[model samples]
Target: MSVDVITFGLNHTSAPLAVREQVSLAGELMKPALTALRSAFGGAVREAAILSTCNRTEIYCAAEPSAARELPAWLADFQRVEADALQPHLYRHSQDEAVRHAFRVASGLDSMVLGEPQILGQMKDAVRTAEDAGALGTLLHQLFQRTFAVAKEVRSTTAIGEQSVSMAAAAVKLAQRVFGDLRQVKVLFIGAGEMIDLCATHFAAQHPARMTVANRTIARAEGLAGKISAGTMRLAELPEHLAEYDVVVSCTASALPILGLGMVERATRQRRRKPIVMVDLAVPRDIEAEVARLDDVYLYCVDDLGRLIQTATDARKAAVVQAEAIIETRVQHFMHWLGTRRVVPVIRDLHEAAGAMRAAELERARRALARGDDPEAVLEQLAHGLTQKYLHGPLAALNQSEGEHRDQLLTWLPKLYPLRER
Candidate 1:
């Protein structure tokens, strides 16, 4: 079976967070999801990688072509969404199209914010998770390694990432709208991952009155806090410290909501109804949606940030055209490599078969010479034996063929077995 290199998924462009969260796989759950996908599909799917990020959840697979067709149904079943409902939001690509998609994604062309660099790290994380899950194979491994290379090349060659508006920047922009001056507000980052780190950096630059990092792992929180000279606390201490900060940004891989309606309600009451700007960057959401209804709690999910970043769409379109041209050229180059790979087995078989035929004929010629036959005559016999054996099948086919088939074979034979005129 021929394996297709493919990617299919929904992203910020296709579906809202309400739908995206249902399909998003937490890091811990990825291995199990990969295992289940392999088990369900069997050998049709040889190698698989799942990339679940805040903006997208894409599956990259090196699998039989049939698996590509069937994957959507499998995803729908796994996500417990209607197949029809998911189909419209999902995009599928095969072969070079898949390679192009992977490259563009890593290079940030497909990002909600054009040329944002975070998706590359997220893709790397997903690749690592797939490796740990034992879902990575030579095809996917090579594809991703090249993907990173392409992303690096594009970043260096073009101004793709320059002056790009990042999700972190958008988060900061939203916070500024709520709080007139970020310098007077205290900011809390409720996760130690890349997104939280980024948000911390943006807010830290604004020189907030106080900055705190709260994480399930206090060590990680402290590590991030130390980088920005911010205070750190364990996630368990959030309830007590929640009211102290006016701006809250939380993005974690947690499967459940970290900040519930009640928690925020209590925190708001403690602050005497002072406005609290909350940005929930997690797919499953770190802040509860119900908290958005509360008067003092201004809750913003991933979708909210996505909207803020959309303003760059017009400016990015020009770069996108250039990026697409680069991607198209690279796709063709990769496909040519794939094509060369396909005929490798045929080339190997031809070499082995011809070597065996040569060896057998040479052995026969040596025996004849030992039996006192003339060397020149024996060499002639050897040449005849090799030539006859090589041409036997085609000669017989041509002779047996009739009408148009015979004429076609006659036309092809001389070209296939060209003779040097004496």
Candidate 2:
């Protein structure tokens, strides 16, 4: 069976944050989702991986071509959303399109913030998790290896990353816009993940009066605290200290919103309606949508930041054309590799049959020598026997065919045995 490379689901370009977040999978949630993906359509799905980030929730798989329609429906069912509701936002690709999508995404050309390097690392993590779940098979493995290689090539050769407007930097910019300077406003960073860490670095550069790290894990929070010279607090301590921070930037893997409308409403009341700059950088969002209605809150999500990063868009757009050309070339190469992979089984069978013929011929030659037959004669017979065995199938086919079929065989026979033509 030839397994195809297929990619399905929605990205920021296709879906809104609300829909994207509902379909997103992370950490422990990935295992069961992968299992469900592989089990879909009665095992047409051979291997699968899901990439669920703030901007996209995509499924990459090695499966039968028939699984394409099933994949999106399966995703809707898995995410507990209506299939019709999600269908319009979904996009599916296979063969060259799928390879091109993977390459463009890994190279960051497909990202909302064009050429953002964080996506490559996120893709690598998705592949790793797929491997851990035993959902990565030969096709997906090769696809991702080539994907990463193409990403490296594009990044190294193009100026795609130059003058980049990162989400972290965007968060700082949003905060500065809200409060003329970041020097006096106490900043509280939620979660100790890469996004939070990056945001922390950008915020710390502004030399805030005070900064605090809030994380589910105290040790992780402390680690970030030590690096930034900030105080640390447990995530459970957020409600008490929420009123203290003038600016909040959160990026956590929590499936549900951490700060609800009521909680933030209370915090704002406590703060005497003092405006708080809040950047929710998580996919599922650490902050609730309703909280944005609060008078004292200036809320920004990942998508909002994507809109604010237009400064580098022109430079990145120029680089994108060049990077896309590179990706197109690599995508063709990968598809060629996939085409060759489809014939791997036939190639393996041919090799095994040829090996068996050689072994049988060798056994006969040895037996003739033991029976006092001439060694030279045995060697000649061995060569003839092996040649006959190798030619038997093709010769039989050619002999039974006529006209076009025979002509076609005659045309290919020489190519198969170019030594004979010589």
Candidate 3:
């Protein structure tokens, strides 16, 4: 049975925030997800890796083609979502298409914000997680290594990442649009994760009138706060303190909304219709969707920020063409490697059969030598036996074949043996 490379999942483009959040896996859930996927396929999924981020959730696997079709339903079952509902948002890629998708994703060509570099690190982390779960086999290992190489080549050789604009920068741009001058607004950041750290840095550079970091872990909040010379607060204090800030940015791994409609409503009441900018970069979302409906709240989710950052410069447009060409060339290279692997089992069987034949002939020769037969005659017989045995298969095929097959065999035999020239 030949194994195939397959990629299946949904991203910001294919699925909305609501659909994506339902299936998104946190960093700690990767191992368990992979193990479950492997078990669900009854070992047919020979190798697997799951890459989940705020913007997308993807599963890459090496499996037989027969088992590939069932993957979409399996994902729905595992994520406890209705298969019918999830199917529309899902995509499946196999063989060369799978290799191309992996390359494009790592190169950031497939990102919500094109040419963003963060997805490469996220992909590396996913590979590491798969390795830790013992789900990474030779095929996937080779794929990711080539994926990283392609990403590096694209970034270095092209201007793909040049004039880079990230989600963090987008958040700052949104806030500035709302408040006119960031220095006049009080900014509050929720969660101390990478996204929040980035938002803090960008907003800090703007010199907000006051900045604060609130996290479930006070120590983490304080650590991030100290770097930006901001104050720290416990996440629990948000209810009481929410109205004090003109700008609020949040990104966390929490499975539930930290700021619900009721909470935001109360905050709005306290502010007396004063405008507030809210950026929620979380997958499950730190703020509830209903908060967007509030009159005084300017709400932006990951998708909204995605829209804000897509104003690409002319250089970036040209860079995209260059990056895509690089990715296409690398994808072909990877597919060629996959194609060559199909002959591996046949080569292995040939070597094993030859070894057995050689051993049998050697044993017969040893017995003759023990019986004191002529050494030169034994050596000649052994050489003739090996040569004849090696030629038997092709010779028999050539004799049995009628036309085209025989012609192919005749053409290939000389290539198999350049000694025919002598």
Distance from true location, Cα of 265 in model 1, Å = 2.1
Report the C-alpha displacement of residue 172, candidate 3, in angstroms.
1.7
Over 1-422, each residue of candidate 1 has an lDDT whose tens digit, in order, gives 88889898989988888888889988888889899999999999999999998889999998898888999999999878889878888999999889999999999998888898888988998899889889998888988998898888888777787778788998899989988788899999999998888889999899999999999988899899998999988889998889998999999989899888888899999999899999998988888899989997888887777777666545466767777787788888888978888788889998999999999999999899899999999988998999899988898997799999999987887788876755
Clash-forming residue pairs, model 3: none
lDDT of 1: 0.88
Name the runs in model 1 displaced over 4 angstroms: 77-85, 132-134, 313-316, 363-377, 396-415, 419-422
If ranked by lDDT, best first, what sequence of candidates would result? 3, 2, 1
TM-score: model 3 vs. ground truth: 0.94
Query: Higher-lDDT candidate among 2 and 3?
Result: 3
Q: Give per-residue CA lDDT, model 3, range 211-315, as digits (tens).
A: 999999999999999999999999899999999999999999998999999989999999999999999999988899989899989999999989878788999
RMSD of 2: 3.0
**Which of 1 and 3 is the better model by lDDT?**
3
Tell how far residue 380 is off in model 3, in angstroms: 4.0
Q: Each model's TM-score?
A: 0.90, 0.88, 0.94
Q: Please report the candidate that would top lDDT against the real structure.
A: 3
Whose TM-score is greatest here? 3
**Candidate 1 global Cα RMSD:** 2.7
RMSD (CA, Å), each prediction: 2.7, 3.0, 2.0
